[model samples]
Target: MHIGKAIRLERIFDRNTKRAIIVPMDHGVSVGPIDGIVNMKEAVGKVVEGGANAVVEHKGLVRCGHRAEGKDIGLIVHLSASTSLSPFPNAKCLVASVEDAIRLGADAVSIHVNLGDETERRMLHDMGKVASDAANWGMPLLAMVYARGPKVKSEFDPETVAHCARVGTELGADVVKVPYTGDKASFEHVCDSCCIPVVIAGGPKLDSTEAFLRMVHDSLEAGGAGLSVGRNVFQHENPTRLVQSLNMIVHEDASVAEALAHLNG
Candidate 1:
């Protein structure tokens, strides 16, 4: 790893634990101002207060949520965008650049790619370009890789998830985010195949905090680096508490029950 990349990664990952609790706030570009994040600054404060390592968002929203006081969190500029209203929502396009992210004071930059989309070829091309630019700039790139296509029978299939993670690593991503394969045995296979750090996506919001924490615990047991969870953390009744629980599991090696206890206590 480049010295510059390592320095930047230190801002995102716990130095002692080598894990991260990242809150992805870039969903507005895809789903629009949903609850829990309509007030970006407040939501960001909650994340920081809970000891989250980083938060990911588009370039425009960076200043909106950045704090002038308090412990700072890592800022990752998301480079892709595709609205839910679009007929081809899976067709993510490069809406920003590594240079743009640098100008925005980003610690890292991220891109999204759906491997099985009809526009997969185009997205892959864009991802390569971004990876190249990121390399030139000595910036870390987080790839949100998913197996979403007409032919895909199950998005959470271990083999499919492994393919998605490897695609990110092959394209030069420093970190890859993919759906959890539902079990530790299967998920461990996905982690083993990827050279870069692999983080699990939050997917849809879950019914309970304990349930969400258990998923995080299971993923960590499968050898995942950490989490890039979004809705599940931000939409919880107490976003700060939820992030605290996540931090416990991801960085402190806390069990699911212990994390849930911290949330409830």
Candidate 2:
């Protein structure tokens, strides 16, 4: 790996654990300014305070969230977007570049690609180009890969998730994020097949905090590198506490019960 890329990746992934607890705040572009991220700086601060390794946001929002004080957190500039208001919401298009991320002082860059979509081909093309540019610049790339189209019955299907992860790895992503397949065994298979670091995505908010923590714990047990959860963390009643719990589970190897104790304490 390029020395620069390796150094940048360490900012995102904990050096000791080789895992990450990433909070994606790029939803403002996809779903408008939702709860938990209306004030980007505050949202970023909460996660940083809770010891999150990184936070992902779009290029435009970088100014809104950049911190001049407090503990430093890795910044990952998201390079692709598709608004929910659009008819083809699944079709993500490149809205920024690796160079844009670099200019913004981002520690890494990320792109989203929805496989099985009608415009999957175009998204793949864009990802390929961005991957090349990122390599040339020695910028770490995180690929958010998902299976969301007519043919896909369930995005969380283990095989489909594995395929999504493999797609990210094949296209040169240093880290790949995919929806967790429901159980440890299935998700283990997904992680085993991908060579690069595989992180789970926090899908729609779950029923309870325990359920959310359980999912993260299970994924890590299944060989997952960590997570790139959004709503579940930022939208939680206590975003800081939630992220603290996540850090314990992801980096400290704390059990779900122990992490829950920390969260509630």
Candidate 3:
């Protein structure tokens, strides 16, 4: 690993572990107040206390209050934008620059690119440029890759997810955030191909805790580094305990029940 990449990784992980838990709070840009994100600062505090290594957010969130919100956790500045109302919502554009993130003392940077979309090539082009900038500045890049297009899988098949991860790795991402393919047995292909550290994203808040924990455990069981869940953690009734339980699963390798015991917020 490059000295710079190693230094940036330290900012995002606990000194003793390779696995990490990061909460993404960049929702304000797309879905305003869907759920569990009513208070960004408060939500981040709960997760931080529970031992998340870092939090990924848009520039506005960081500018508004992430510093005081996440003083103890790493901050990854997200520079991409896409909205729910847009007909071509998958076409994300770069709204912020690496220089801006560096000035804000970001530990890393993240961007989202939907592979196979009509505008896929354009998005990848932007990602390449952003990745180059991050490399030149010695900052780590986290790529959120999702396969979406005319032939993309409806629920994200293992193969498609693996392909997405591979694309991110080939494009210079230090870490690739992807969606889980239901189970450890199924998603292992993604981890195996990317080689780069993988983190699963929480797509939407689940209806049950069992479903949530199962997904987290399955990801790690397969070979993932950790999770970048936001709504699932912040929106839970007991944010503190929910996050703590996630920490137990991700960091301590605890079973679902053992982890759940610590989650009665």
C-alpha local distance difference test of each model: 0.93, 0.94, 0.86
> By the lDDT metric, which is better: model 1 or model 3?
1
Candidate 1: lDDT of 220?
92
- Record all residue pairs in model 3 with backbone atoms less than 3 Å apart, i.e. clashing: none
How close to the true structure is residue 264 of candidate 1, measured as C-alpha lDDT? 91
TM-score for each of the candidates = 0.99, 0.99, 0.95
Residues 202-224 of candidate 1: C-alpha lDDT, one tens digit per residue: 99999877777888899999999
Q: Which pairs in model 1 have colliding backbones?
A: none
- lDDT (tens digit, per residue) of candidate 3 on 96-195: 9988888888999999999989999999999999999999988999999998888785637888888889999999999999999887887888899977
Backbone clash pairs in model 2 (N, Cα, C under 3 Å; residues 3+ apart or in different chains), count? 0
- The per-residue C-alpha lDDT of model 3 at residue 39 equals 71
How many backbone clashes are present in model 1? Answer: 0
The list of candidate 3 runs beyond 4 A from truth reads 67-71
What 10-residue stretch in candidate 1 is worst by lDDT? Answer: 207-216
